[model samples]
Each structure stands twice: as C-alpha cells, then as structure tokens.
Target chain A: MKDNKPEWYARMKRGPFEVTKFDSEMMRKVEERALIDRIKPRKKRFSPWAAAVATAIVLIGVYFLVPKSSLSYPDTQEVGAGKSEMTAEYVREHLKIGMAQEDVKNIFGNAAEGQSVKRDFAQPHQDDPNDMRTWTAVDIWRYDYGVGEGYSVHSDLEKDNGFDMPGIENGNIESQLVIVWKDNKVERAFYKYMSSKGLESTQIGPAIEDFPDTEPPISDEAKHDSEYPSLEVRAIGESTLGKFELRPRKGSAEKIQPLGAPSCLGLDTDLTITGDYELFFKATAGGESLIQNYEALEIIQKENKAIMMQKFDFPKVELYLFIPRYTDCHGLEFYAYGIDKKTGEASAFTFQEGDNAIPYWTTSPMVLPTQLDDQLVVEGGRFAGTDGATRYRFQPDLNKHQMMLEGKEQIP
Target chain B: MLTRDYLKYVSDIPTATLQELMEEHGQEVWNYAYFLTKNVDMSDDIAQDVFLRAFLHIASFRGQSTVRTWLFSITRNTAINYRKNAFFRKVTLLEWIHSASSASSAEEQYMSRTFTDTIWQLVLKLPPKYREVLVLDAKYELPLSEIASLLRVSSGTVKSRLHRARSKMKEFMKEVERREG
Candidate 1:
C-alpha cells in the first residue's frame, strides 16, 4: 500500500528526450508512406512451404521448418532438431483456422497449457436495432514448448507478473502457440519463439478480417420465431427458443444468446421473455431431449429477472446456469439449474439462507460460479448486514442427478 | 485533446483528424518510441510508422480505450517489431554507442545551458518493463488500468513495477550523489 508518488516524478514530467517531434515535416512523411502503402498491391499469400523457406532464408540458421499441408505429421520431436518441438513451422502446419478444441488437443497430444473464455460485447447503437451488440465469445488456448530451468531477471519479472506477459523472455524461453477460438472454431492462431536477439511471432495463416460487431443475419427457420410476444417450446425439434416471464413495466425482454456452452447442445440457447408470463427451459440435442419442458419454478418464484444464461461443464456433465440481471435484494444473486445431459434428469442447486434452504444466491459482491474438482462453488456476501463473503459448495449425488449444498465457509 | 470531434465510426481517418491527432499526441508518441529504443533516429521512424499504421488500420480501432492509450499500444508494438528485426537491431547497436556518447554530451550541454535533471537519464537506464510503467504513470499520468491494458499485464503488476521502478531510481540517484560527492 505504498501509494505515494515520488517527488522525482514531477521533475520527470518535463521529458528529457530531444527527439524528432511529430511536426509538419514528420507528419507529411508519414502521410506519404501511408498513401504509398494503401495504393501498393498486397503481397500474394505465401503457401506454407514458401512461407517456411522465406522465414528460413530471412532468419538464417535460427530454427525454421516447412509446415506440412496435411494434418498427418510426425511427432513433435521428429519435426525439428535443436529447437523447441512446437516450432512456428509445426504450429502453422497442424493448427488450422477452423479446428475445434478437441481437434487441437488431438494434434498436440494434450489439452492446452492454459485456456480461458471471454465474452466481448460492443456498445450498440440505440437507433438501429440491427446495430445491437452481438455475442462474440473469444476462447483462447495457449501451448508452450521447450523447458528452461534457471534464475534470470527477465523470467523472474515475468513470473512475478501474471502469465499473460508475452514477447519478453530470457534464454530459457518456451516456444509459445496461441490459438483464438470463436464459436468453438479457431478464429486466429499465432506462434512465438525466441531468436538470439529477441522474440519473434508469426501469424499462422492469412490475416483474419475483423467482423463488425453487429447482429448476424438470422436464418429463415430462426426468423419464423423472431416475432415477440409469443412462446415457442420444442421438445424434440432441432433447436428451440425459451420464452420466460417478465415484469409488466420492464418493456419486452431482449433475446440474449447465452455465453460459451458445450457444442453438444448443437443449437444456440436463445432466451426470449415476451408478453406471455410462462417460463420454461427447452434444449434438444441430436434429436434427443437434453432438457425437456423443465419449468423454472425457482426462477419464477423469485421476482428477479434473468438476463442471460451460461453453461459450465463437469467431468461428463453440462449444467446450464441462468443469471438474474437485476436483483431487488440488497445483494446481487442468481439461480442455477443442473440437468444431466445424458440421463435428462434435472436438479436445482440451493443454499441455506437462515431458516430456509433457498435457491442459490449471493450478496453484494457476486462471485461467479467455478468448478473445483467435482463440486460447483458459488460465493457471495455483504447482503443486508452480512460482513464477510460466504462460499457455498454444491456436491452432486452419486447419480449426478441432484446437487446439495455441502457446506458454507465464511471468507474474510 | 483535439477540440474537433476527430474520432467517428469510419473505415479510415480524415486528414483533418489525422493532423489533429498528430498535433495532440505526436510529441508524446515520439518520446515514447525514444524511451523504448533509446535512439532518436529510430524514434523518428517509429513515430511516423505508428501514425501511418494508425491511419491505415483505423477500422480496427474499437474505441475500447482512449486515442492516446491506443496510440501508445501501437508505439510499443512498433518498437517491439523494430527491436526484433535483425537489420534494425544491428543498426541500433551501432546507434546505441553513438547515442550513449551523445547523451553524455547532451547532459553536459544541458547542465551549462539550463537546469538539468538526471532522473530521466536513470529512467532510460532501467529495464524496459519498469521504465515503461514508470514513465507512463509519472509522465503521462495514465490510470493504472490503462497502463495495464497498454502493457497487457495486470494492474497489480503495473503497481509493482512502478514501486520497483521508483525504488531503483532512488538507488540510482543515491549512486549519482555519492559519485558527485
């Protein structure tokens, strides 16, 4: 908590460098260069082989290999000599633009070293509904190759900071492969490795064109139910939208497709609340009723409105959790429901609140749900007069059909 | 900041907007490049390239951060790319020796001509990460969150680096005082 700024910083603000100022002359040169680059024809897309050869020539003797066009390739060790197994060549050859997470795991012989999913929603234009924010969930997977054991200033600083620090490295740097997945498909991939002088990164394929953050065109079939003020539930159809209850004054609820869910659902789980006050959850996968006509009684009982739904997985189970946007209670809270994907049996996750075992909820500070081992933990605190955070763990029964609160720990 | 509403949802930046941006942040960007590379000539090229890249890739600007933060991120990336380029590194290695000598003479010249502070010289001598967070926080007065975003590290990391940077600067200043004494 050393929050005070040193007095020397005030003196440093004057800036000691006497460099080329961004004057009219420099601006004119930059403008000219930009104009020339815009008018110049882009270089032809380099084939995998050509790109490798070009890289090898440019970086002489500094570890480069030809990317194989086919997925069938030798093991990591067989691919290169005297360099990290996950070379830029090996990554570019194996990782395709649209490969799935499982496909990546298959190629790399294991899951990624680190992975995370983030939902990025752009601010929507109020005037145009078409300009509304679309769901763009970016799932990133990182694979590191090579191993180094030594104490160095660069690596030590990097370790002190989080693992997200890329590019900076000492001699014991790992050849890193990063894959950005969108909608369960590889959207972008890059490989990074250290040369003698510094770190070098290579984008695997053609530069990905940035898709404007606008609502995608709904299909003709999906367009039919695009109308509001109606409830459409399908138990055995290909895909269906869930219509939920909404408070009369809050206007028509916006249809928000939930965040990253398993691909096993095979359909976008759309939650639409309209004129009808019926709340139901419908999910169909492979022409099977993953969750059929499951009434959200707990959600309906609580007057709080559910804004979005998120699905997280266990060993062999997937649970869909609905998040209430606005809670009238002193603290933020949400309700979660779990349905065994294989057995189609449903369960509700509830925690003890005083005398009553109420549906799962947290207080002022909302801690999102995360799976630890075989348990689902939801944490919240500072509700009403509560001081510290409360941690609740939900341990599913042996059948995995029900989840009960195992215990609550008061976090300081 | 530019008085004119320079940023609009557009595929490319208008010449007027570009001029306004350069007028507003050009010197800061140039100085930042110098901080990274420690070479004035390379800083010149890098500053130009940053604006040029910004002009060409205006469509990619999502307005997640302010124009200044975006420009600084670009500057850092451009400097990193330059550092990685073997040809530029060789040229910079030679420039490093020349700049070192020129910097010492510049220090002497500034001492006689005007009041000179050796703190920035010590800042330039610090490692890249610490130097960047320190300069960005102290000079630009950017929020820790923005520095974290620009550096692609956590806010905690930025705070730690800042603390360590100031400590190192204090040590360097003490050393200078000892030598002078």
Candidate 2:
C-alpha cells in the first residue's frame, strides 16, 4: 500500500486496461441472445378504478364550462375592482428578462405615451443630429394614465433598490421623486404619489442649461418661461438592479435634492447636473416593489446619452391575477430583467400565461427561489437596501394571488 | 409497417451484434469499476451491470456525447452505488482485507508476484477521486477530454486529479519498498 509508483496507477495513465481475448469472449456469452430473450415483455392492463376516475374528472370539467346565469353572483363593481387588484399582482409575479414591446403595451393599454431622448457621443455639440462618429443614445419612457400608473424606460431605479416608498408607506411620500442626470446636470425629473391616481397629473421642465447669465436675477416671467421652473418632481430611475429617488428643494428654486440619494443611487449630491439629459417616471398602485429583489439594469452609454435596460429574470412560475373582463388578458404579462454583475449587460424577458404555464399547483405558501439553493446568486439583492424586502408589493389581504416555480422537465 | 421480415431481421442479428451496436464498451467500463471496487470480480460484475442497463435504455439515447463516455458514466454510477449499498459495504470490506492478506502471503511464497500485487495494493490506497482518474486513463485508455466530459468537470480538473493520483500512488509505493526491505 505504501508503494507510490503502483503498477495499476501507472497503467491508468496509459489508458483503460485492455480487454483480454478471454474477457471479450466471456462478455459475449453473458450478453448474448439468451439474455435479451429472457427480458420480460410488458402487457397493458385495464383497471375499473382508473376508468371511474376518468369519468368523474370529465363530468366535473363539463359542470365548470356550462354557463349558469341563474347562480347567485356578487355585485359587478366590487368584483371588477377585486379583479383589477388581482391582475396587478399577476403582473408583478412572472416578470422575466427581455420582455417584448407589444407585451408592455398590452399590459398597460394604448392610453400610455412613449417618449425618448437621444444623447449623441460623436458631435459633443447638442445641435449635431447626424454626427456619424457619435453613438446615438436613446431613452424611451412610456406613460399610461388609464392604468392609473405609468413607467418610463429608466425610472425603475428606485424600485430596484428596495425602496417601495410611495406605493407602500405613507408620510414618506416626499422620497418618491427621481431625477435623471447627463454629463452631471439635472436632465429630467419624475415623481410618484401615494394615491391610486399616482402619476396621472404631472408637469414637465424645459432645459435648464439653455439659459445663461441669469444668476440671482429672477423675474416672474423668467421663472414661467424657463424649463428649469417647469421640471416635474418624479421618482429617480430604477433599473432592474438599481433604485433612485429625487425630491425638489423646498421653497427654493436653485437647490433640489434627490430623495434617498447617496445610499440608493450612489450619487454624491442631489441637485448637480451639467449636460443634456432625459428622464422618465413610472407609478403603480398596490403591486410588489421593484426593490428588495435581485434585478439587473443595463446602462449602455454611447457618447453624451445613456440607454438604461432593465431585465427581470424571476424563476418560471405560475401567477394568477384577476382582471376586469373588458381589459385584455393578453396584455397581462411579466417582464424579467437581468443585470450582469461583471459586464452590466441588462436583459429582459416577458412571460405570458398562455406560453409559460405553471406545471402544477401546491397549497404551501410561496417563498423566494434564492432561499432554496446557496449557489443561486440573485444580482440585485445586494443593493436591495438593508431589509432585503421583495421588489414587488401587493395590497394587504385583498388580492388573492398564486405564484409557483415550474419543475424542470425534459422537452417532449 | 409491421412485417414478418422486420421481425426476422431483428431476431437474426446476433446478440453480440446487439451489444456491439448498443455501444457497450467493455474494457473502459470494467477499468472504471475496478478503480472504485478495487476487486477484479466485483469490477467485472459492475461492468456487466453497466452494459445491461445501457442495453435496456439504448432507445432513449440521444447522441450528445460519445458512446464510450456515456458507458463509462453509467459504470461509474453503478460502481459508486454498489459501494454505497449496506450489503456491498460489508462484503467488499471483508473481501478486500482477505484478498490483500492472501496476496501478501502469496507474494512471500513467490517473489515474482510481488511487483504486480504491490502495485494494485498501492492503487487501492490512493484517494477515491484520484484513483478513479488514473484507472480511467491507464487501464481503460480513455482520453483526458472524454474523461473530463464524463466526470462533468473542466479539463484542468481531470489533469489535476490524474497528477494527484500519480503522486499519491508513488508515495505509497515508496513506503511499501521501505517496509518490505
């Protein structure tokens, strides 16, 4: 046993042991026709119990399909509202990375508006539209008043940081505004209200840097005409991985501070923006917070402007949401955003009910998939504030929803 | 499509043809089992089990990897599971000690048998993972790439395991020489 250069170990280096002629012959005999012939053949058997169960299942299915107006029903108004709340919960769950554009429009409805700003990297000058040498940066922000909430392409930064401020708690409504900066100047602003109609009514600001040589010499007319005065208080951009909040300065025109700025957005100070910028805002009622959970926000900066991409990659699971009959079910979907820790490449996936169905249902309460395995590292969880709460929030005890991960199975 | 001729064609094919066509590689499978069980008879049994299981599941096989790699994977699993079973544990331990003592006595009677017996005993002393990689390369003639794929590890892992196995085996052999002398 003490021999270091054992013959077997040395032989193992050359390759597996050679099959001696006797060994091959012995194998042939043991594995030959007689063994194959001895294998027992299977036969199908009919069972009365199985037949009875199948019949009962078919009858129950027929009973649910039959329309019965005679059955006593709850009032439509209450039911409709309940259904809307459930639908909102469904949208929160089942959000995957790389969701399609059509799926977003379907969920939020056509009443939403989409806006974009392009930052050119080549021209360095704001006037050059066709600077071939510059990278064209685009930020598309969509707004939907009918859904009572809207989302911009880049405003999810706060949601990704575990700060569900305006949606969950009251009194902290002051921390719901977000500011977008380009080249270190305040470019755009977004805000969310705690009310059901959170972002329905908001104001827009003109370019602040456009005006020059008017320090401490402000007239009422100049304040009205300047874009700086018109800036709307908005939530800072939340990517799939990051969250930000911006609050306008109180009683002063020159100093606006970002709510929850340094810790949440990694910004040094609040009201500092020097170059051209674009900002978008999104607000929803009684859904999960986009903070707390792991998420990825991909920011692709091409010259002066940056495009922020969010990817939500929740595990494949079944989500049930109640929605009004009038609203399209097809629109109800989830988008997943994944942010690569090393390369900041954010990807998004939109999951639909018809395509991605829950394979089975269980009565056990739901839990985050990350807790089940140590190896599964959720990228956004580290920045999800101190409490490590879920990114999506839901109404208390009102919306009855189910979310489940589908078991892995081989594709047939 | 179901015809007598088709049945005859399948039946006429020799059973050895079934095993060969089934891609049941015998030598590699046996060598890998030997690495685990360290007993020639038990290794042969494990190799047979691997081939039989492969034959039964051949229809489900999709050619993702080579037939040799797949067969060796089955052999490794079969050998490991056999070693884990309570009955196999008791029997294998008893048999290992008995065989080692007997072989040692036999070597005393015949000096010529000492080298081979001593080498195999030292191989059994190496750690399980290292011994496995060495056996796969030396006895079975499997390439490092195929072994890496079979083990579901990086190529560097296979090389490192082999290196460790060689060093450990060498150390064991040196100790044996000192004790015997």
- The lDDT leader among the candidates is 1
The alpha-carbon deviation from the true structure for residue A96 of candidate 2, after best TM-score superposition, in angstroms, is 40
Chain B vs. true chain B: TM-score for each candidate? 0.85, 0.67
Report per-prediction Cα RMSD to one decimal: 20.3, 32.6
Q: CA lDDT of each candidate?
A: 0.55, 0.38
Model 1: runs farther than 4 Å from truth?
A: A18-20, A37-412, B3-8, B95-116
Error of 2 at B157 (Å): 4.6
Alpha-carbon lDDT of model 1: 0.55
Candidate 1 TM-score restricted to chain A: 0.29
Query: Which regions of candidate 2 deviate over 4 angstroms?
Result: A1-25, A32-412, B1-14, B19-24, B97-121, B139-145, B153-160, B176-181
For residue B21, model 2's alpha carbon misses the true position, in angstroms, by 6.1
Candidates 1 onward: DockQ, in order: 0.14, 0.05
- Candidate 2 falls in which docking quality class? incorrect
